[model samples]
Target: MILIKYIIRNHIIPFLFACVVLISIFLLQFLMKFADKLIGKGLETIIIVKLIVYNLAWMVVLVVPMAVLVATLMAFGNMSQNNEIAIMKASGISLYKMIIPPLISSILIAILLVYFNNKIYPDANHAARLLMEDITRKKPTLSLVPGVFSQDVSSYAILARDVIQESNELKDVTIYDYSNPPKVNIVTAKEGKIFLVPNQKKLIMDLKVGEIHESDIYRQNVYRRLRFTHHKIAMPADQFTFEQSTPGGPRGDREMGAAQMLAIVDSINKVQSSYQKEFNSKIDQIIDKKFNYKPIDTTSNKYIYVKVEQRLRMLENGFTDVLNRIEYNRKEINRYMVEVHKKYALPVACIVFVLIGAPLGTMTRKGGIGMASGISLVFFVIYWAFLIGGEKLADRDLISPFVGIWSANVFLGIVGILLLIKTAKEKVTLNFEFITKRIPKSWKSSDDEIENN
Candidate 1:
């Protein structure tokens, strides 16, 4: 019991460390990729934070399994390096028994992850999507440059000969208002100050020594001009306001839970079954018609041939329609099934990684983050490649969703079991010195420096 406790305890710090590092990396990447969309939008701090937090759900899902792999490698490799494995073997404790605690723990983690994926991940994805849409719909703060026409506002354009950035002042401003149809309104001011309302719902421009020119489009001869010492124009600024919408709407496959997706897939399958039956019946009818043809003595040969051709054409069109519907349903089923399997498949990877990590860790006998990360990176790359490629193939109806999503786990699980069995019976060591030798001296020196730090 003490030994098992100690083994499990060793994994805690490494797993947490791996999770933090991976999540930070993912968060940084997310920020960098979306910086353009978020910057200069004048969004509240909370909105941006909410977006990051919502997106973290998916990052957590991806990071947890990889963290399992890294933690396993580090824990076992440290034990092996310290000769603890040798001591245990001398006392008759097999590697298999030492693995039991971690394996069981991995199963529990997998279960929690499954629940999280089905319950929490979907809503987070949906909320993130809606929030992003709202953010994109929001226009950036109003900007006007000197000697340029600014049309950032709807149905209005303002040209300024000189703009004072510090004072929010414009000189020799010319405004064109197109909010009303069949009427042309132009305002020119000697100087003006422009500012937005506190709620950001309206833009107000105060002009001094300006003239308003109004003319009707249909009546060219009718024109009115008025001179004023001071005037104010209020324009709608709703688009510039950052309004958060409630997250409620139609969701895509990635935004639905496995149970919901499975229900959809089942419904689609029933529809496809109906289509298949209808297609079969149509084929039977066509066959009957083809075999039951009888020549009429009163009908000319040309008319008979034309009738047969028309019937054949109708049958062809019907068959094509039924076949197309079935094909479409099949594709839909594949898409939803892929998502359903994905919900479980990725969570199941925690267990699979444990199987692979334990045996490989013992063989490598290295516990440093650099070594474990490098090894984990290679395996994870291969795993993700299989997963991504499988999803694409499954979506195209080239393969079953089961095969597409679970192939990585199966392949790695088998390899892990084989390695575990072989290592249990004997000893094996993996030589990674050749890989290190290929690294440039500068890179190796930098790695060494980081390790020292």
Candidate 2:
């Protein structure tokens, strides 16, 4: 009992460390990719933070399995390095027994992850998507350049001859207002100041020494001109404002839970079944018409021929429509089933990684983060490649959803079991020094000299 407790305790720190490092890496990449969309949008800090937090749900799902791999490798590798495995084996404790605790822990983790994927992940994805849409819809802070027209405000165009950035002032400003149809209004001001309201829902322009020219398109003779000392124009600035929206819409595959997706697939199956029956009936009707024989009067041969041709054309059109519907339903089923399987498949990877990591760690006999990370990266890449490829194939109806998503786990699980059996039978240690030996002596000398300097 004490030994099992010690073994499980060793994994805790490494798993946590791996999770933090991997999540940080994912977070940095996300920020770099989305900086352009978030910058200069004048969004509240809380909104941005919420967006990041929501997106972290998916990052956690991906990081946990990899962390399991890293933690397993580090814990076992360290024990092997310290010769604890040798001591334990001499005392009659086999590697298989040592694996029981971590394996059980991994199963519990996998269960929690499955719950997280089905409950929390889908909502987070939906919220993040909506938040991103709101951010992108918001225009940047209004910018007006000297001797250029600015149309940032809806239904209004303003041209400024000179703009003072420090004062937010404009000189020799000409405005074209198109909020009303058939009547055109042009306002020119000698000096103006533009600013957005506190709510950011309206833009107000204060004009001084301006003339308003109003002309009606329907009546050329109706022209009015007014000169004013001071005037103010309020324009809609809703596009510049950021609003938090409630989540309410149809979600895509990635935005739905496994149960929801399975339900959808079930419904699609029912629809597809109906479509198939309809298609088969149409085919039978066409076949019957094609094979049936009918008699016609000799004097009415021309009319009978025309009637037969029309009937054939109508039946052909009906067959085409039915076939198309069936194909569409089939595609929908494949797409939803793929997502349903994926929700469970990724969580199951936690168990698979532990199986693979334990054997590899025992063989390598190295506990350092560098070695563990390198090995983990290679395996993760292969796992992800299989997952992505299988998803694509399944979505296209090339493979079954169960086969597409579970293939990686099956392949890796088998390899892990075999390695575990072999390691139990014989002692094996992998030396990586050969890789260092391959480095050029000149390069090594340079590195040594640099270190010395």
**What TM-score does candidate 2 get on C-alpha atoms?**
0.81
TM-score per candidate, chains pooled:
0.80, 0.81
Residue 31's lDDT within candidate 1 is 99
Candidate 1 per-residue lDDT over residues 38-111, each given as its tens digit: 87666799999999999999999999999999999999999999989889988999999999999999999999
Clashing pairs in 2: none
Candidate whose lDDT is highest = 1
Question: How many clashes would you count in candidate 1?
Answer: 0
Candidate achieving the largest TM-score: 2
CA lDDT, candidate 1, residue 153: 80
Q: Number of clashes in model 2?
A: 0
Give the per-residue lDDT of model 2 (tens digit) for 1-453. Answer: 999999999899999999999999999999999987887666789999999999999999999999999999999999999999889999999999989999999999999999998999999999999898778656532357788888877788889998875466889999999889888899999999977788878888899998999999999989999999999999897765668778988898889998898898888888888888888887887777763435477666676677778888888898899888887878788888888887788888999888888878988999989999999999999999999999899888899878988999999889888989988888989888889899999999998999799
Model 1: colliding residue pairs: none
